[model samples]
Target: MANPVELTILIEKIKAKTAVVGVIGLGYVGLPLAVEFCKAGFRCIGFDIDEKKVNLLKEGKSYIKHIDEARIKTSLPLFTPTSDFSRLTEADCIIICVPTPLGRHHEPDLSYVLNTTRTIAQYISKGKLVVLESTTYPGTTDEEMKPILEAGGSGGLRAGEDFYLAFSPEREDPNNKDFSTSTIPKVVGGLTPQCLLAAQTLYDYIVVRTIPVSSTKVAEATKLLENIYRAVNIALVNELKVLFDKMGIDIWEVIEAAKTKPFGYQPFYPGPGLGGHCIPIDPFYLEWKAREYEVSTKFINLAGEVNTSMPQYVIQKTIDALSENGKSIKGAKVLILGMSYKKDLDDTRESPSLKLFDILQKKGAVVDYNDPYLPEMPKTRKYSFKKTSVALTAENLSSYDCVLISTDHSAYDPVFIASNSRLVVDTRNLIKDSHKYKGKIIKA
Candidate 1:
């Protein structure tokens, strides 16, 4: 229902890079997006409820490890970071990059998304374009947000008429060298055709490619499928890992051999557990949504079960290693190598290392951790550990009864750790030369 005149005006503003782009939630997803928008020559305003983050941006500092301070300093002239919701009126395009976490019962928790929508509704105006970049289930943009924006907000301006709405899931991979925010392709879906055009034109300036989909629901489902595919495949390898461990088969060597086939397969390695913001949580959004239609996601549910039980499996491996050394599980000093989920990054969101730490301490093992990326354990939604990273040294490694490698960081010297430690429980298969160590290493 939007007039061609209004749509043309929005497109022109984006083409000329004159539009004021606003991004809500200045976390890993939102901050990079705002920086990319600024790099595309648009004036970007970043909003966050946390004043600490806003102050850090104002000081030209970068909190995330992968995003350099040089990038933040360079974009300081065009970027504005603040906690003011009233400034929403000044933006021609608004993007929501808030968190969509799972509830205690694994239900899709849309509180952050819904609260952001209500706030946007208060200040949105005619001819403004609003796109959601937060990952959620299908029908969230049209079914949840459209009704709120159309109900007496912005003087009852109708969606696709006086205003525009769309969904483009945020694809942010922190510390990924091959893809940056601007280089990644964006899949955008709109509530209406005009809405799609408006949103796509705005994103075309920042991203390498814009893939326009049919509806917001399709875009929403696209994100879920991407993550659920990863969750399922990882679970498959993890299940196989346990089975192979029983048969004395090396899953790592099997993956190396299987990946020799160039055409038919993609390699997904198993680890302590699923980590990061997306894979562990995003699949459940679709699983939760499926329940409304009387459908059961048994495959996804079983994958979740397998991935969730990995930490316990790692714990049992530690116990077995300790027992073989004639040491009791309780009162044994165990050192954990690397706290981050993956190698070479400081991001600890939903990291399996945290679960390992918690389980080790509860089992009466004196646990300590070391990570070159993190000096201290970061506070997360579910964890609060008053512990700092322990230094990894020859003497320090030799002092511990057992050393468990939870994360395979590039900085770790597998030979040094294997040689120094009395017992090494290798969860990530870091110590490949176990033959030379002579029973020093045990693959978990």
Candidate 2:
């Protein structure tokens, strides 16, 4: 397998754009990646166990809003999604974009990454480049993944000399209008210099910016730190919001004023709670991993705890609102508007809406939600409310005793909801036009 002639043949194929680029775990991160590589003129093969996604993608349709349908359609022939691991040998380059969800005890679960590496190592040959794009704690790439590949293969071939291995963390922000897969600067760190150069060659062909780091741990920590900054700041604002709410002050307005200072205050607004993939989950992975070093990430751990309590807090407020109107939450029909974590995106991974729904149900309220982007939710830790769609009409809003704006999806007209709803608990300041709403809003 380490034959130089075989390696040279694979190199020629890659250089000639005839090499296949196989991507495992074709979800939000992987699909866009396959398209990017295909657009860069390589034949890309995507692997996902979900046959539904494979069928949908093969038909030139995109499930993600940020991804252009036509762009995907054009590259559909070059990009293929399959469920078989035996087909891994078809690719000259492999990228792992699988999920890295937290375990029961909040540990960094490298199971999916390990499973994928073991699968790929079986079919791996010389000159193939493997890049892990899944987010994890530091040292996962060189320390964890490198050995799995070398150990699994039949021949006792070394990592860098026989095959290239690297870690390039995915910086994808779903529903974000500003950044996309290709536009975001990709950070690459490999086990060896040749590994780095090979990975750079692949990414440079597709991504506009590629940053090479000293080692895999550096690249791993870079992603964690980026998300940690967000988690801590959001926690600070959430605390500020709680304090300011007690004083009958609006935190959004305060952020607006502070943002004008232009020097230090980078404004981060409070909401129902922390949601989305990176902010809500990535910080905890580091917190769990830091225990290995016997170092307590107190700030990160506290922020996670504080943010986790926010959904219950919002529910308590809504319950209070109901009680103030001489109504009990037990029989109340509460409609939550916006299910996606952010505005105008179909991604609902790690959305705060899950906790909100569970909390509302625990209070015995009849829970329902409205979101054009989401018709159903994939089950995740401790919460499993199959998303049932309801209209955001005048009558529907009027029926619910309380309407909570869980997520501020862009398409929702706040004026419409406020006018129709009996009582609205606005968490995201969706109904910021107080003059328009005539002060019927409870700013969370």
Candidate 3:
């Protein structure tokens, strides 16, 4: 058992010296966290079960493009990746940033979290701090997680004495240029004051603000609230998008006009649908938990439904645009502009672009995608077309009757792409030649 004085000195040591920080699951959130710790002058161990990722780190190669190559090449000595759980003994603080994807029924599937906890539990020891950065239910850490870790040890965790536990939801916006992982404020909560103190101290080293919560549930709930807010607002605009599409009015114009209000309105744009990690997945965690309490989350559930219908709507629009050109979707060569979830990101998890592909294929359109980052869309429920063709050139693009721009990738050479293509269906408002289809460009 550690006294308050001892823990205080320990925290001071963490802030002063190069503490060994272990970041498990080297995906988007974990990779950035490891780099942030290394940049903060802490030695970091980026642990992942995937041997390929571990081997890449060993060779100083980075798979994710958003992460700087210089960081991997130059920062190799401070950064390391390992699959061995025994190496976790060297860590002063450990953070779990693995995926918490939804199940088939859209329920919060905690298999990743539970399996990660099981692995971490095997290496359980005294004095090391643990924090869950995965977005999931509020009671995950204190309720489900605690018992699992306790089962691995000889003695049980006495809240703050034997081991420390906390939940600090990662607000990792993958492609956002403005806010970095260090600049974004973090919300942290622990099982007890000591756990909170230790977790807050560690995050404060790399992040701009450490907003301490009273309990782990608050920290967990805070993440869901942020995502749910986005989901609801996006659904509202998506609702308007469909409405305006039917009324022959542009939703983008209405949004621009509304943004003139200084205080009342904050802008949220409607897209093909919700994409990326948090907004599409995190709200479902809250919804799943609400069910355990025998409650219904009507607004949130309905928002997900509305946002999900967007891809079909886009597909219908594409068919209409092509038909207007005296072309049919069946056996028509259709080119999709982007495959990644959003603009500038390589991450395709829960991307609406994939759904659009499925819908297009279902309508008998010969679907092929062109993305600079992702050469092809991987195998999914409907499409197995993950092969990159020639770069988006006029000759290749001109052959297709219509080009549906799903993601606004930064690499798009817009002027050239527009010139070669017969008709462009811009779902993301990428091409601002907003004059709808001079028989050339259609804004879906």
Candidate 4:
């Protein structure tokens, strides 16, 4: 097959580092990827609907924690952050990195993806490459987006010919010192062979490597599989955590000992619950898609059930810890440590801590939280705490009836927390040397 003129032009521009790249949704995934593209010598136009984020980036400031302002300042010459959608025509390549959250019923919510596509279609022209980096169910690029773009204002322009289309799932691990957007291997899939090549060539300039798959669905499924693998493993450990608690065995210690064998075992830690954008939600995308094919994803559904049940388990542990301390959960003064999903990062999407907070408040416990990373609770899709982090002082720590350690951020001093608190519920296994603080600690 002859390469489309769009593909040939895009490839030439990409190699020459002159391609004007446009990235939509400048959040965790988009911001880092756009910065990498700028560092790779491409002039990138970063698009976001949030005026505050756009304005901050325009002034070389970063809203995301791990992405330093110095990096944004350095990329300012080549990176332009804006809320303008009409400027889409100025770019030779566009990448969509919007959030693919689940709806109320756990169905795949592609409003962000589809709305961005519709905006791109308005300004889309010939000889441009379009790629979707949002994590979604298989066939989204081909089935949902392609038709929208084809029937868009471009006068029924053909995909893979008029404009290249592809799916390259984002692999963003925030606060992981080991990996960044540029270091991670990107998986690219396209609607056609030319679409694949164009997308792969573009990512090759910024990323370490590009793994090209047969089709867009394969690429989408590849991402789901990566997260689902983690989801299932974590669910296994979560289920074991409940059982091991009854058996008087420490799941963390068991994992540490089991991981010594190295060959047959990989360790997945149990937390309060699943947090972050990918693992907690990505599996459901596949599960929801499986329903259309009249297939039952029993294992995946079971994993979801186990993972979702973890927050309640954490609550039960809290209740038990309080009861042991000669108090009831009702009217007990409780303080939650760490508001963000994971330790040391401010990204709180799907964080189980929110669920825990709502449950505790509903259960009539006086709840407050402290996270060094998050000062005030921001409004989320399903939660609105309207509270700021209390100072982690010795007096403040001693005041709470029960102190629950949800995120084991490195900033937290285990000894200090144990010495001050009346009772503690340790979820992340944050405290070590249990003999010294035996009376205060309860591992959830």
Cα lDDT of all candidates, in order?
A: 0.92, 0.85, 0.85, 0.93
Q: Which pairs clash in model 2?
A: none
Q: Which stretches of candidate 2 lie over 4 Å from their true place?
A: 1-13, 435-439
Tens digits of per-residue lDDT for model 4, 330-419: 999999999889999997899999999999999999999999999999999999889999999999999999999999999999999999
- The residue-level lDDT of candidate 3 at 326 comes to 90
Candidates 2 and 3: which is better by lDDT? 3
Error of 3 at 313 (Å): 0.9
Ranking by lDDT: 4, 1, 3, 2
Better of 2 and 4 by TM-score: 4
What TM-score fits each model? Answer: 0.98, 0.95, 0.95, 0.98
TM-score of 2: 0.95
- Backbone clashes in each candidate structure, one number apiece? 0, 0, 0, 0
Give a tens-digit lDDT track for model 3, residues 322-365: 88989999998889988888788777878888888788888898
Q: Candidate 2 on 1-444: residue-level lDDT in tens?
A: 244664566567767888889999988899889998898899999999888888888888887777888988999778887887799978889999999987777777789999999898898777788999999988888888888888866767688788888899998887567788889989999887777777877888788899999887888999999988988899899989889989988899999999999697798888888777678889988887788899999888889887887887788889888888889999899999887788787777778887788888887989999988787765666677876779888999999999999888778998898888889999999888865765557887
- Which scores greater on lDDT, model 1 or model 2? 1
